[model samples]
Target: MKKLLAFLTLGLLLFLAACSSEGGSAKEPGNNGDTSDSAENAEKQEVTFWHSMGGAGQEALNKIVEEYNTSQDGIQVNAEYQGTYDESLTKFNAVAGSDSAPSVIQTFEIGTMSMINSGQITPIQEFVDADSYDMSGLEENITNYYSLDGKFYSMPFNSSTPVMYYNKDAFKAAGLDPETPPATYEEVEEASKKIVESNPEMKGFALQAYGWLWEQLLANQGALLLNNDNGRTDTPTEIGWTEEEGKSILEWVKRMVDDETFANYGTNGDNMMAGFLAGDVSMFLQSSASSRDVIDNAPFEVGIAYLPHPEDKERQGVVIGGASLWMIDGKSEEEQKAAWEFMKYLQTPEIQAEWHVGTGYFAINPGAYEEQVVKDAHAEKPQLQVTVDQLQDTKASYATQGALMDMLPEGRKIMETALEKIYNGGDVDEAYNTAVEQFNVAIEQANAARGE
Candidate 1:
């Protein structure tokens, strides 16, 4: 009996020892951060990129990723579509709370400040300056919006400028030359009046009427949307768009709305494009990035022109639209290095040119224009050159300057509310003042949250 008892105790001891050993070797819940692994130390780096572009944009992005994946053996890229831009941002924020987030995220231009404030992104300046990467060919202008205080946190990939898209059929029907798009806001108003009076069946001028769109218009007139260095001063600030210039722009819009020259289309994000496609609207003011959709699906000849200015010769350069590629912070050094390499590869002239032509965005690499394919495309379609031509005379606007605030998206919502009021018979000045006040409150909240 003594011997049996000793044997049982020995067996229990051994079992406990085995269990302890197993516990010690198991990895703790691999807490996912901005980086899956250390980019420097990773042996095999797999870059996961979350983007909102689907269809043609997605296909083009995938082609670039595939080429990068095959061009080298050290790293592999995985691309995933996260729906629309807003949805992608929401998904990113949600994933950031867990351990399975992607390494690269594509975020819209306005979202940059919010993302920067979130501290989840790794600056690209480090990667671009790395000995392994060559950034000489990248244009300074394209990189302007992605930079903050001389440090680049993101790389400009699919950059676009807003332009005037007029339906040639509508123009001709209205007895206006399709080639002579409105050159100024006054011209636009006059043209809109004529077009509306001529074509009672369709709306004359269609604005996307989003807050961002409003900001763009304000910027065109040299107005500042936010007070603190236009959000670049790096401090808490309030919305200043209720000022004289901003109010004037809104009043102009109100006039158009009142005259029935403009159509709201009820915030169907896709409806503005649909309006153009269905011939329900005469012309559209949208980003050049939309060229692909119009070309691929429009029922008639689409005319592209530079965004009209408040003055004919004084058209302030329009701000860039579209998103940039941002690397999530906290990745393994190896992964970051690989991401850098892939970014450099993606920015090559050949790739940029092909992407710009395929996706209807301007190439971040100026040298991209020298490529044979780009030359051929520009020759074949002259309107595709409008973005480039306008950019030559471009100067960033006070309001259009890249925003740096956590509450900008909210501010945009406030402006949208103001727009809604204007379109729905509210006093334009009163609505704008209310929006400005509301945005200021949001700004204060954001600043407080950031402990600024």
Candidate 2:
């Protein structure tokens, strides 16, 4: 009942704007095969798509929109570049009270639960079911993350996984086989020790103090990042870092820091990458989405491999780390249908392949590998295939499905803070308990705010 009240309150903000005289009857300029804007008789549907991507990613998105616009004369989608993911979500929520929200928006995986709770989204399942769309070509593991209650809430896009990136030259110099990178945590430690022992000036590895990496480590071990099946069964009440998997990761990191085999490069992946490129470190773990820039900019030869798993466990899986397209609720049926059409157009093999080649993100559509562009790129850079195989082979599990808590973003903050505490001579048990207590407080507060 509380949640419903909050939903009503949210709807009230946009109610007046939605009922405004212009909003009730205003129509977009139709593309009706006529070059002139004077084709008043042609019916036009407009969709606003807000996103946080910029640079090469943004360029690819714009190209896709352009192609879609030219391919149809019924709907015209205006792609707006909002700031970061957080900023875009914030702007979206701020305007939730008004009828100014975009017809569709791109939100990062972290915001999935909050978006659902906001009660302002029309699940993609509704439209797909209405048309009986074929989704067999899409990667199941990638789609699993955006799904809830046994259905997809949004359309997956620009998906990625974390991979171990090593310097081939460093491996060879350390008398290790460049082709055989570390496959287990013990192997990583062995290689790092050798590299550092051989070259005292260079460090073995430097992991960014990042929540995503921490979460991936748990996923790699098939450990849930939170309880209640990552909060899918119920709202997550606390953090999961004090669990066995999380403890093992923290201990390993602490041991490495003490042994001088690893160092925390703060919370920035860019800094970690810079250290690797500058020969200060031999190995770094980063998102596969960064492959293009790392390969193009690094001075030394680069090698990619699935992230190291604990010796006890095989590489079970990794979580997706990108954004998905969500159709906002409260739009006209025509606008909603048009948004669905644009989404389907983007999923075509040719466009997905183009997106994969242009940006480093994987094509969510499995069939996209058959496209000439993807095949040609694979021929040129075989390392790209490593990432695709990783996602394709990852087995579906609660851990790999990724966390679904409404307090996920806040939970990550708590985990990162606790990580910093661990690195700074704080007691792991103490830090863990404190994080749980604090995180639950945050959850309760958030729940109260939402009337959940």
Candidate 3:
């Protein structure tokens, strides 16, 4: 009987030890007594950002994120690189219906309309109002692109304008003055002719896919891509490219193709940039964002100038390009507040100037231009200063109204198809009109699909 009692006591003690081990195992890492209370107080709120900035640009963004993470303790930002601008939009659209959406996204200015209509974004106005952040210092015209129905949706981060990038060595070889890049459309044509005639081995000029080139040409001519404030207020109708200015742009493109002055450098800006960098193209029209890539990689001397307009002085303004950071919906007030803090932190003058100097993107904050640090940085590298000059007197273009068409990508596709047909010896006007008809159908169908 003594031995039985001893065995029973040992068994009870073993059972108690097992229970304690299991309880300890169930408790989560950093969890205290109250699970809900611990989650509320101890959990780190993470904001996920999806962006298209790669190469050196992405490294610069990573540095900014690291700085922010070290300076703060409550929130951690995870920046994920989502390849190229168009690919980033595609990935965002694919994941829009899932619960696994990013908390913050970097979207191109052109695609802002789609994001707004998707109802997945939390407007920046809420954060601004809550924090009483002063936005009066922002340039009105530049800020207007991201505003919809008089409410700001996204914060313009890396704004850029079209600029002329010329190869000075190519110009010299072509017997053209390397010191003076083309100042007008007529001069562009004339110089292009001289360049091609003198250097038969190289293409005189190169323009990126149909959409990028056509948008600038349309803007330079002061033509609207759509009626009624360029789709700023969500009108259903689209202004076809068969109009006077649109037709004129097509005609000019056709002339360039026929004269063999402009080479087809694939559908993206990087490809055209590669052609320029290789010394296979004399001149390239690209964004201010390309300033860093060209300066860092190109072996030849590069020249920068404003986008050329016709002889008319009134047509000097060009549209802004690049991307903006947007806040996502479906988060709690605390999370929203945290996200807003991160957003505002990114807009501070020192941060803006640092990012601009590091990545070749224009500083969206107006005071960044006047900051002595920014001025000193520009003084060291004069090419970086050209971006500020380009945006100094800039006006929003027709398409820059951030067109609200649901099928804009489709419209751009149709436009490209029409241009391809014209380039391959088809009728320009007929192809353009046919493209317009197809685009209208796509737009109407897209709208219907959305039940709008």
Alpha-carbon TM-score of each model against the true structure? 0.85, 0.88, 0.85
Question: How many clashing residue pairs appear in each of the predictions shown?
Answer: 11, 2, 0
Q: Best to worst by lDDT, what's the order?
A: 2, 1, 3
Per-residue accuracy of model 2 over 1-452 as CA lDDT, tens digit each: 99999999989877877779656566657743454643521456888999988888999999998888777689888899999999999999999736899999999998998888889998899987899986656888888888788787899887899998899998899899999999888888889999998889888877777788889988999888877788777776655444677777777677677778885677777888988888999988899988887887889998889988889887888999999999999998988999999899888888999999998899988889999888999888888999998888888988888988667777778878877877776777777777668777887787788777
Instruction: Tell me how far the alpha carbon of residue 295 in candidate 1 is from the true structure, in angstroms, after superposition.
Output: 2.9
lDDT of each: 0.77, 0.84, 0.76
Residue 335 displacement in candidate 3 (angstroms): 0.9
Give the runs in model 1 whose Cα sits over 4 Å from its true position: 1-44, 97-99, 132-136, 311-313, 397-399
List candidate 3 stretches off by more than 4 Å. Answer: 1-43, 84-99, 240-242, 396-402
| Segments of candidate 2 deviating more than 4 angstroms | 1-43, 239-242, 424-427, 448-452
lDDT per residue for candidate 1 within 95-152, as digits (tens), equals 7735577888889887888787667888888776766455545765567666677678
Decide which is better by TM-score, 1 or 2: 2
Model 2: which ten-residue window has the lowest total lDDT? Answer: 32-41
